[model samples]
Target: MHQLNSLEKRAAIALALVFSTRMLGLFMLLPVFALYGEQLVGFSPLWIGLAIGAYGLTQAILQIPFGWLSDKIGRHKVMLLGLSLFVLGSVVAALAESVYMVTLGRVLQGAGAIAGAVLALAADLTREEQRPKVMAIIGASIGLSFAVAMVAGPLLARWAGLSGVFWFTAVLAVCAMLIVAFLVPKSVSKAPMAETLALPQSLAAMLKHGQLLRLDAGVLILHLMLTAMFVALPALLNQQHLAAERHWQVYLPVLLGSFLFMVPMMIIAMRRQQEKRYFLINVLLLVIAMLICWQATTLWGLVLALLVFFIGFNFLEASLPAMVSRVAPAGQRGSAMGIYSSSQFFGAFLGGLLGGAVAQQFGFVAIFAVLAGIGLVWLAIASTMQVPSRAQRLSLPVAVTTEQQAAALAAKLAALAGVQEVTILLADQRCYLKVSAQQFELAQAQSLVAVGNQ
Candidate 1:
């Protein structure tokens, strides 16, 4: 197995911290906002839910634009600008006296939209072969951050109230900025590739891809249920006589226990090559969890429901992105991911809106009932998704000085047995290929490229 070099390691750690800190700032608000938000002027279930999800709306809109801008100017500059907006938004929320002001602050925070830039920068800093590991590290950090935020949010709220939480978020944003400015290794300036950067022209084709669209909708619905659940979960806990500060006691155990169950399922699915099977099972698990939440009458009952929910949530969260990578057309992964991410953020926005509306009209428990229905719809759609074949992506450096040469090389590579897709970039001096895992012969491909170069 290949290993990341010292520089790759440093870049991975620093960027992971940056990603985690920003995510933590966002997630901390998820668990505590409902309970403490009531203290603000103009507080209502609708406004509180909107405030919670308001950042997602802007994040959905601007993530791609920020990514494209980073390609135009530079990654570091765009990241700094995004982090600055985040810090400013956090401060605004910290000082807000009304829920609407807090919502405005959240919107500003979303406007920062650094996720795409961060990924692009990571792509710049690592080798193609090592990129998956780097991304896994970053993804793991986001998950860890969420677990920590769930526990820490309530504790912080107990100590400093909601404003204090926002203040802490602002501090985190500053730390991320510092990481971007000083810690992350500088990347070589190059033209962004369709593999790593979103190309606007490719958007429509990705939208029309049935498998990609299904994955996109899956993420959207998953996040929608998540944000909507929080809209009422805190209040439900409070009603069950659990104090706000003590909510962490429940979150810590449930999260930990859920991982215990989730990891085994993940391993089994991978080992058996039964991802679609497990995927459907996890989706069904979510539905069951929501139904449990609807009927739970005691604290323990709700805890059990949450345990089930997280077990499914964590697995799906990790799996969906991987599926998107596998299902995406060769050379167009960037555009597919851009659309998928936007859908996720938009889902969060909708979750807040719809979750709040349902909770306001029908009460908190009703939100779960609605979510369960949505899960069924997703389950039905997902049932028809084709299992992604085992495919390996290989990036090979080729000596080609002209567009015609590059085109000739691409055509030759595409003719190789087991090659599923091929993309050649003349400026990058590389050919990107997706090939069958079992049938692709590295030696054969290398020999062909060598002969062509000679």
Candidate 2:
């Protein structure tokens, strides 16, 4: 935080708010979609699952493209386009009269792909030393959004229904657009071209990087579990004759109770320097919870299972990115994050669709069994992963503009003391370095920036 200027902090907070508002619109339907989805024309439980997770599908496909586009067109410009797409999709969803149309709307909704763009832009504006603080704010916003959705979605569904919720999201999209235009300042980095990355290489680069792939795998599993549960949760609640309006009573307690357990473990992992051990244990717990959920017959049993479930879910959700931020190549952080994010949305889509089809035909028990199986496999893989301490990012402006000069400067910066990784972009005139924060202070990094300029 000492590294971040006032503008950077404000932008980070504003971006988080915008991101959460949009994400909430997507998740608001998750808690109770099954109740209303069945009423629309041609509503099969599986189709209903698609409608709920549709946005994720499009988001998954487009995030890397959008991130790359931002590198070429500027993050703000790319973000505005994404936001407009969201507004358009929201309108389509709000107007949908059938399940098929709603699915179309969801795909359109995901076309926004603004989240990656916004994150990239935030990184562009702030110093690397401040990113964790910035990311922490965004992460908190996401957790809060999930908590708020659990409390608010059901109540809103009772009053306005899914169409109404989409309309509300459409309105929020408009609000986010205005904020992007006027409130967020335009960013222009002065770093010489070599460190900043191109958008087109995002996906390919992420695919090839083993360290980043681990994080991506983790994200995919997390959302796979999330969407799978959401697909069945409402229908299960309905079996108890709980209306959409009343589902929150169950959600509220489960979410809150889980956080009580989740927060302490997160603290212990970081504070006690037991991140790898705790992370692996968390995945194992997820597997156990899934098995418990499969066997739950009473609402109390379900509630207990959910507490265990979210403790695993939320902890992984919080910790995965921090791990990626630490281990990914410095020049490729934006691209790595782009891939990680895409996997999350993709998992949501696949999870929802698969969970629905499986649950609709085989039974809810089968769905949990499948999810548990996946969790166990993921846990095994994760236990074998290299758990590296987080590496910090440092950005500096460069005076050179030509491609050759950018490459030369990158080499020079790479040779500098304590720099572990380097990325330089001639076009963006930016250079990014991954350095040991424990070994290098903010003032030292800043001084290096000055030296690079000279």
Candidate 3:
């Protein structure tokens, strides 16, 4: 029931716009790129796939470094630099006459890697209790952006061709930069919190966490299937006698109907506390959808398959990150998310590489079969994942100056009723805790910390 204040609202809205615009630019190419990629020099299924996924490779590689860099220079500065790179890449891609140049542009675009910095700034601008709400807004924007891009990509391509789409993406990136410059509120706290910023020291432990790894693998496979599916889906529709320009007609209704179906499933899962059950079911749904896509001969048949696919895809996309937050250790959520995001981007790269290769060697239908197999494997791995506890994390400023004081304070906080975990960072003068949402008392925690400071 915690409400976001005025400043929090402004920050959340601005940051969400910035995040979504960049994502919109990135995604606009997914649906239309394969069809138009043939017009470029050195056009081939393999190169086309590589061009589609090249950005992900750089994004996965540089995102963590850019985040660490943000801590040194400042969040706003890093964001500006990142957005600038995105614009430059878009422009490069727009002007390219060859697949190689477009691939280079996509790689440059990925190098922006501003996701972590943006989230960190969000954390700095909002209170701990209000952070989840802000994150939800941003998450919702991403999903909405993806849905919009799927429809818009084909329409834009019909009007302007492939280069036109890239030009529009460049324009969107520039607008995002302007938003970052003027609309997004600056973070008041410069001190990085482990709950918000990735710590290099914690990376190994997060990598080793079995549960967190499952979620990471899940996102990787999810995006992999998504990108790989797109590698052939547009062409599949085109083969069904649907013109490229008319592709939006199919996407529009299918996405709308799928969203309607997905909402009820999400509601039921949450209300019934059957998230794990629903999660597995959704995975199974993806497998079934892929199999149908592989076999469908008619346009409507493919549409039906896509409808089923999106229902599962949308639900899993929303729920997986929530699972990561729940499974991550109290202070290491940032590190866990960092890894999860990298896995996601890397999966995109793999999808393009593998999908293109498969299409070249085995043809389009084989792509879906491969994806279905991957989904089955993922479902098996995910079956072992334990249900995460309903623990909420809180980070509070502490006044302890010495390690001894910090340790003593951490022990006291750990011993509090309903507190599941406590991590005190002396350097940051902050304490992070994971506690049962229903049983934890924030007032008591604040009082105890205040006394410890005194």
Candidate 4:
């Protein structure tokens, strides 16, 4: 196991805090926004749904550009700018008295678009062996923030109303800014690593990759179902005579149950190297949740349905990025992640749009049917996904003077024990490899080329 250095530890902690804080701000609105927006001027179900998902649209648009800008400027500078935009958007939403303005505020909020930049920075600050652990910590933090926000959103709205939530997020954004400026140390580049920054030119090839495409589509459909479900769920609960303020009581216990179910499955998957089987089962769980919702008659049945839904949601959220990292071609991981993130946000937008429209025209039951259909589509796609190799990403520095030399060296490494794939960057004196954990001999690999994790 690679130990985290002092800087890596500090960076991971600070970055995770920043990420969780930002996500909490975003998610804290999901459960309560629909109810409170009815009091605003020009409010309607469709606009409320659009308001809920508007942030995703802007986020999808700017994620790549912000990351590219971070590469040009410094990471902290870009992060600060993103945070500033987030705070401004929060304030706008806080002051708005109309649904259209709220939609504008949500769009502004999405414009921060810092997820790619944050992940890139995390990659820059950690070693290859330690990167997965660090990323996992950050990913877990984001997931926890979502869980917390789901509970907190309703409770806070009950006490302070919708505007209060926006004000609170603005405060959180300010704290995030302080952390970015003071607590987080500057990242020092170790070597030119492909996974750390987006490469626009590589997008075409990554899109064509069957395995990567499956993961991308999976994330898209997953989030689409999530946002769409929430668009109609609150109303369904209201129809069942559950007060809006009491929704948290239902969300809290179900979220906990989902977490309990999710953690064990993730552990078993990792321990036994059963990524494909676990993924397939989780997708089926989601399908079952949708089916349960389709027939739900009581609040308790709905609770059980959400429990199953989140179990699948949380599992896929945790595993999908790891899958993307493993399957993406070397030197293109960042671009691949950018696309993945964009797809996720875009799905949120489409879900809100489509879900709200469906709910308005038909009923919440129709929304459930639509989401169930989506789950079935995802099941088909996920079934065809390639199982990720049980290898960690490792970077090796080689002494190659020519393109031909680098190519020859990469071929040599490919035949070595434990090596599954290799991509040599002729311009960078570096080679990226996927090596089997049980079979990879780091010492032998280093003998051929001066090995270092990029």
lDDT of each: 0.92, 0.79, 0.91, 0.86
Cα lDDT tens digits for candidate 4, 1-454: 2489988899899999999999999998889887877899988778867988899999989998998898889789999999999999999999999988888988998999988778888888887768877888898899889989988898889899999999999999999999999998888783354676667777788889898889999998998888888888888888889998899999999999998999999999989989899999999888899889889999988998999999999999889988888888766677788899999999889888888898889877788888888888888998888876666778877677777777767877888888988888766667888888899888888877753321
Question: Which 10-residue span in candidate 1 carries the lowest summed lDDT?
Answer: 189-198
lDDT of 1: 0.92
List runs of model 1 lying over 4 Å from the truth.
Answer: 189-192, 397-411, 425-430, 450-454
Worst 10 residues of 3 by lDDT: 188-197
- How many steric clashes does model 3 contain? 0
- Candidate 1 residue 418 Cα shift, in angstroms, is 2.9
In angstroms, give how far residue 226 of model 2 lies from its true place: 0.4
Off by over 4 Å in 4: 399-401, 450-454
* Residue pair clashes in candidate 4: none
- Report the CA-based lDDT of candidate 3 relative to the real structure: 0.91
The lDDT leader among the candidates is 1
lDDT of 3 by residue, 1-454 (tens): 2488998899899999999999999999999999988889998888878989999999999988898999889989999999999999999999999999999999999999999999999988987778899989998999989989988999999999999999999999889999999999987785345877779889999999999999999999999999889899999999999999999899989899998999999999989999999999999999999999999999988999999999999999999999999889888888999999999999999999989999999998899999999999999998999877789888888899888988888888888899999988777778889999788898888998999899
Give me candidate 3's TM-score against the actual structure. 0.97
Q: Give Cα distance to truth, residue 236, candidate 1, Å.
A: 0.3
* TM-score for each of the candidates: 0.96, 0.89, 0.97, 0.95
* TM-score: model 4 vs. ground truth: 0.95
Each model's RMSD to truth, in Å?
1.9, 3.1, 1.6, 2.3
